[model samples]
Target chain A: MKITILYFARIKEVVNYSSEDVVLPEEVETIIALKSWLSGRGATWQKLFDGSGVVRAAINHELVDDMATFDEGDEVAFFPPVTGG
Target chain B: MYLKVSVQPGDFDVGAELQQLRAATPQAGALVNFVGLVRDVSTDGQVSEMVIEHYPGMTEKALQQIAQQAMQRWPLLGIRLIHRVGSLTAQAQIVLVAATSLHRQAAFEACAFMMDYLKTEAPFWKKEVGDFGQHWVEARASDEQAKQQWKLPK
Candidate 1:
């Protein structure tokens, strides 16, 4: 399945792209799986996807927990936890 | 109910907004206001400037939902929420929430509740531009805990 990932804050700086398309492995079903898959991309990807990282995930525009599942073409945004008032 | 969410490279008058709300609702005997300001520190380093970004359609909807929640929980006679996005200098206001009711406790509680929700739940994001370049401030555990205090039935 294909998904678009969004980057914000330091995550955006490390990723160097606001959003992108990627083909997911069959094992990548939930947001946790998706992050795990992203972590395997390389060192830079791993830094932002590390489980302890402050990244927040959203399935489409609705914020989702790491266990939330994703469908094809789902919009996933990853960023530092929001700090706006 | 009055809401204004915009991305302007400018400032606003909270006093004026309060006056407008007061004039618009004669029955309101109390006004609760929350003013958000830009600070001068970032986790990265000393912050000199901050830039705010937001999802246009989504931000307004999220804010209105907060106001609606306050109305449902309290006897608010009027509600006004305004949030500004874009480059902001230190000490500049970012958002304001004013809730008016027949009693001070209702107005104050609802206003505080709405602000707490916005700090953690809203879609707006701010990038702190400091000596070390820019980085978005991570969500604070304190905020989540503060919000949780209100979760019990009241």
Candidate 2:
């Protein structure tokens, strides 16, 4: 399946890309699985997807947990915890 | 009920906003507003500049959800929430949350609740430029705690 992934804030700085379109393997279904598949890219990906950071995810403009499922054209965004008011 | 939520880079006029909000509903006998500003001092040093960024579509959605929650909890006639993004200087207005009600207590509580939820639930981030250099502002545990206090009674 194909999806558009977006990175924001510090995550975007670390990933060095704001957004990208990627084709996921069949095994990758949920956001957690997608993160695991992307984590295999390299060291930076490992650091982010390691679950150590306070990263949050949103599927198609609404906040969702890692268990959230996505379709082929879904938009997924990853970023650090909010600090705004 | 009237609810306005916007995420923009430009500054806002609080006086005008208040006047408009009050005029929108004559039955509203109480109006309360809270404006958040960028402070100059930071933990490391003085913050010379600040930058705010947000997920555009998601930001408005989050704010609307917050206002909706406030409306459900309080007897509010209207809500006005505006948060600014992009580069900002010290003492600049960062956010505004206002609530109108038939009485003072509901307006006050709803306004505070709106702000507390905005700090934690909204998908906006801040970067501070200080003597220690630029750094993304970390989410404060206190903020999460404050938002949690608004849980509806069972």
Candidate 3:
């Protein structure tokens, strides 16, 4: 499956890229699984995704948990906790 | 009910917004509005500026949902919610939430409820620039606790 991943706030700074499009591995189905797959890329990815609760995910614009599933062409966003009023 | 939600980079006029809300719902006996400003001080030092970023498409949807919830919970006749993005200086207006109702209680409660939810649920993030350099603002536990009061029984 192919997906567009978005990084926001501090995560964007750490990731050094605002957004990207990539084809996912067959084994990556859930948000957690996707994070683990990305984390395997390098030290920066591991620091951001390997730790639990350090980041939050949203599928197609709505906030979701790690267990949330995504399909092809989904827009997945990862960011820190919101601090807006 | 009359509802207006805007996520923009430009500042809004409070008087003009209130006038429009009043004109839209002439029968409303109460109008309550809240304006949030960028604080000049932070834990690190004096805050020189604040940069706000948001998920564009999701932000509008989230604000609308919060306004709808306020309408459902209270007898609101109209609601106006505006949040400004981009770089802002201290004392600049950042947000405006206003509600009109038949009574003051309903207006007051709905306005407060909307703000509480917006604080925690909205996708916008704030970064403060100060003497200690720039840093992303952290979400407060109190904001999460504040929203618990309005939870409806399933």
Provide the DockQ value for model 3. 0.85
Candidate 3 docking class: high
Residue pairs with backbone atoms closer than 3 Å in model 2 (clashes): none
**Better model by DockQ: candidate 1 vs candidate 3:** 3
Give per-residue CA lDDT, model 1, range B1-154, as digits (tens): 5444444457778899899888877888898898888888766678788898775555676787788888888888888888888888877898888878888999999988988888887777888888898766667899998889889786
Off by over 4 Å in 3: none
> Would you list the C-alpha lDDT of every candidate in the order shown?
0.79, 0.92, 0.94
Off by over 4 Å in 1: A25-27, B1-9, B40-47, B55-57, B130-135
Candidate 1 displacement at residue B108 in angstroms: 0.3
* Residue-wise C-alpha lDDT for candidate 2, range A1-85, written one tens digit per residue: 9999999999999999999999988889898998888889998998998978877999999889999999989999999999998
Q: What is the lDDT of candidate 1?
A: 0.79
Per-residue lDDT tens digits of candidate 1, residues A1-85?
9988777666777888888999988889898888888888799888777766667777767777989998998888876766778
Positional deviation of residue B84's Cα in model 2 after best superposition, in angstroms: 0.1
Q: B1-154, model 3: which lDDT tens digit per residue?
A: 8999999999999999999999999999999999999999999999999999999899999899999999998989999999999999988999999999999999999999999999988899999998889999999989989999889898
On the 0 to 100 scale, the lDDT of residue A30 in model 1 is: 94
Model 2 bad stretches (over 4 Å): none
Residue B149 miss distance in model 2 (angstroms): 0.8
